[model samples]
Target: MDPEKVFHMTGGVGVTSYARNSSLQKKASDMVRHITTDTIQELFIKTTPKSIGVADLGCSSGPNTLTIIKDIVEAVEGSSHKILHPPPEFRVYLNDLPTNDFNSIFKALPEFYRELRQEKSGGSCIPSIFIGGYAGSFYGRLFPNNCLHFVYSSYSLHWLSRVPPALYDEKGGSINKGHVYISESSPPQVSQAYYKQFQEDFTLFLRSRSEELIVGGRMVLIFLGRRGPDHVDRGNCFFWELLSQSFAELIAKGEVEEEKLDSYDVHFYAPSKNEIEDEVRKEGSFGLDRLEMFQIESNNEDQKDDHAGKIISYGAEVARTVRAIQESMICHHFGEGILDHLFEHYGRLVDEEMGIEKIEPITFVIVLRKL
Candidate 1:
């Protein structure tokens, strides 16, 4: 399947929209704000280019999309002050697949600019921040040579450029039978297929960026990852496992065909720290600076005192987050008919699992310096 054509975060302002259900992503993005700030500061301390080029890859449309650019611009402004140099003109690019909802982001830009101007009126030295939307995959070159000083991606890159070919059998059956992603039950070959694809995609990503970024440019990547070298890390595997069970229910009710189960596999993988380091070493264009892992509760929100010893509505919050991430792909592949039922069942399965075992998702924040 073409991820560019099928993949996108849930759009619009509805409850299921990524705009509404992206607090987990917000928290994840905030976690790396310091790293992001320091990297941009280092850029100014080194290059002090007349025009600062920044790109946010996989910048899906939502409140979460422009917020990153805003923070980066703020970082640039603050960093320039410390370096005692006037901040350069900001040339910011927001990138995602061609099918992403750039219009929604464009529609929201007026308010973003207005707020930015209002906030800068006090003492904030506002550089000329020019924002543009670039529609394409980050796995390939998206900017001119040596044009971007810094790059940021959040909650993306776990998606492969495309589904692994090995997942398809000779008869066109998906080798990954009952699961959508890497799981303990997945066949050994299925696991290998995911690892190979991740390595290739990440290598290409680094190669492409190497050409676009100047020497000493920095990139901060935040995404789902495993703690160890295991391909079938259980950190977030249960989420997909329970999601698969939701489809199983539809199959039993005859609302969805069992054959579809054998043909569908999520084009996502959370690589381990070792896997990332190996890929970076092989690519040889960037030096791995810092690799840190953080564990966050399924829901980023604070738990209420009354919710002690209970799941604390984390299941619903998690279901909403997953829905925002996968709704478009699911609708494209499985048809819109099954969405409501599927998500309802998926939420129940998540709640059931929480009652049995609490799952904490692990996020890896990686910083790389251009060589």
Candidate 2:
């Protein structure tokens, strides 16, 4: 299946929209803001080009999207002042799949521009900041050669472009049963298929970016990653297991067919640090500067006080986040009717788990410089 056509976060500012349920992502961005700011500042001080090109790939729409742009621009603006150089004109590109909600982002541009003038440019540098949308996969080329000086992506590289073909047998039957992703029940071959796909996709990504970024350009990547070399580490993969248990409950209730569940698989993987380094070493494009593992507070919620409602609200918040992220793919494979039931069950499972022990989601912050 074509990932461009099948994958997208749920759009619009509704109860289930990514725009509304993305606080988890907001927290994630906050966790890595220092790294982002440091990288941008370092790049600006080093290259103060007349027109420095910046691109944010897989930049789904929401306040977080523009907020990141604002932060980067501010970082550059601060650096220019320190170095006593005139502020460089900004040529910013926001990239995502074609089916992403660029319309909402475009409509929100007026306010974004207004704020930029008031806060960033001091009402003078608005025109210097030119923003445009480029819709395509980052697994392929999306910009001109030697054009971009800075590239950033957050919480997106974990998604493979497509399910690995080796996941199926020669007769097109699923090898993984009763689970959407690699789990304890998954065979060792299941993890192998996923690792192979990630290797290919990440190598292609590095090769493509190597041609676009000029020598000494800087890039920051943030995505889900495991702490150890184990492919089936439960520390960061319990949510997926919970999701599979949700489907099992549905099958038990006769709400979903067993055959349908077997055919569906998540096109996502959380690679270990060793695996990521290996792929980058093989690609031979960028130099890895810094790699850090950041863990999110599982109980990051409004009602942190000890109350029954706390767990319920926290579970609901997590379920909402997952629905906003995976709704498109889940609806495509399992139909939209099962979302309410499936997620309700998933939330309960999460609550039970959270009560026992908070399951922190692990993410990696990787800083790269073009060779």
Candidate 3:
């Protein structure tokens, strides 16, 4: 698989754009701070007198990544201050795919270091950034054993390049199908295959983390997830279904090529909380330190007086980003007009749904630690 081709489909632009958005960054930073203060601090209660190393895996380039790193640094600094001996040096590693926007991340590092220098009050050592080169999946060992004190990953995992071939073809050959995600309501085989892949990938992730983390090292993972008891494919995402329907409508009207629409794929998997916990248990090494699940209320309480205008503006941004992603061919097949039509259709669908007072709810945080 070519890195450029893969990233072009569902990689850089969408993730980078999302990460740069102020609201998302703030939310992620706040969540990281809470996790560090509540769980990580407890784990490091005894591992003093030595410097600590922290890592942010799948850390895409942008202010969002920086925001999370800053929060962790601040928390560590606070923890170190209470100790009798002077605090040890802090090493922070930022790891992402080889095709990731590392240039942006490196460019921002000097500013981060400058800020840390200014913030240091006493004999505190400045935090250092080590750019890590971990190509391919983040589900394997990337660091030395027992080296990391804390590991954090957000909005990254839950993506597998392609569904397992075994699920699609029992003989283990390529099926050349459009996307198994579309077979959501169809056969059990399709869903099972995707689930199996997720299981394998997640298991590898745990095993690798187990080797890298110290006995008491901490990890916090946050991502876009769903809240439901029953497993529904909804095409790997409800949002994707809405966009696809929009595209289908345009194809019917001869506005776009069906071939163009059929050639691409969206790589996202939103697991239920139960499914996630089960995977964690299977890993067997890490113990669940803290897990909190909540529905993020999409409706703005302050916009009660200006509901109509606010909804339109909000829907537009969502549509814009979605369209930008589709237009960029990050998924391989979608063309320029397809994204526009998809966004328009999505906006209309959202408007109709809003009329019924339905607000889409996304899930919240989970934090764990090595036992």
lDDT of 3 by residue, 1-371 (tens): 23334452233434225332335334555745676565655555577736677888877656677777777767665776766445556667788766666776677778987887888757556655454435545767788888888888876766654545554346543332333243444356655666677788788888998998888788888776667644453322556666666766777898866665554445556677887899999889888877666543454222322223442344454555454333444334443435555667876765555556555545546777788
Q: Judged by lDDT relative to the true structure, which candidate is superior, 1 or 3?
A: 1
Deviation of model 3 at 317, angstroms: 2.7
Model 2 weakest 10-residue run by lDDT: 304-313
Comparing 1 and 3 on TM-score, the stronger one: 1
RMSD of 3: 4.5
> Which sections of candidate 2 miss by over 4 Å?
120-124, 300-312
Q: In model 1, which residue pairs have backbone atoms overlapping below 3 Å?
A: none
- Candidate 1 structure quality by residue, lDDT tens digits, 1-371: 78878898887777688887788889888877888888788778788888988989999988887888888888777877877888789898999988888888999989998898899788776569888999998999899899989989998989899989999989888888877887788889988998899999999999999999989999999998877767654576667888888999999999888888778888888888889999999999999999999977553333522223443356667777888889888888789888888888887777777677676669999999999
Sort all candidates by TM-score, best to worst.
2, 1, 3
lDDT of every predicted structure (CA atoms): 0.84, 0.88, 0.62
**Where is model 3 poorest over a 10-residue stretch in terms of lDDT?**
299-308
Specify the highest-TM-score model's number. Answer: 2
For candidate 2, give the lDDT: 0.88
| By lDDT: ranked, best first | 2, 1, 3
- Please provide, for model 2 over 1-371, each residue's C-alpha lDDT reduced to its tens digit, 9 standing for 90 to 100: 67789799888888788988788888898999999999989988888888889999999988888899888888888888888898888889999999899988898889998887677455445537788999999999999999999999988999998998898999888999899888987889999999999999999999999999999998999999888877676565778989999999999999999999998998898999899899988898999999999888776344632223343367778888899999999888889999999999988888888878887779998999999
**Model 1: how large is the Cα RMSD against the reference?**
3.1
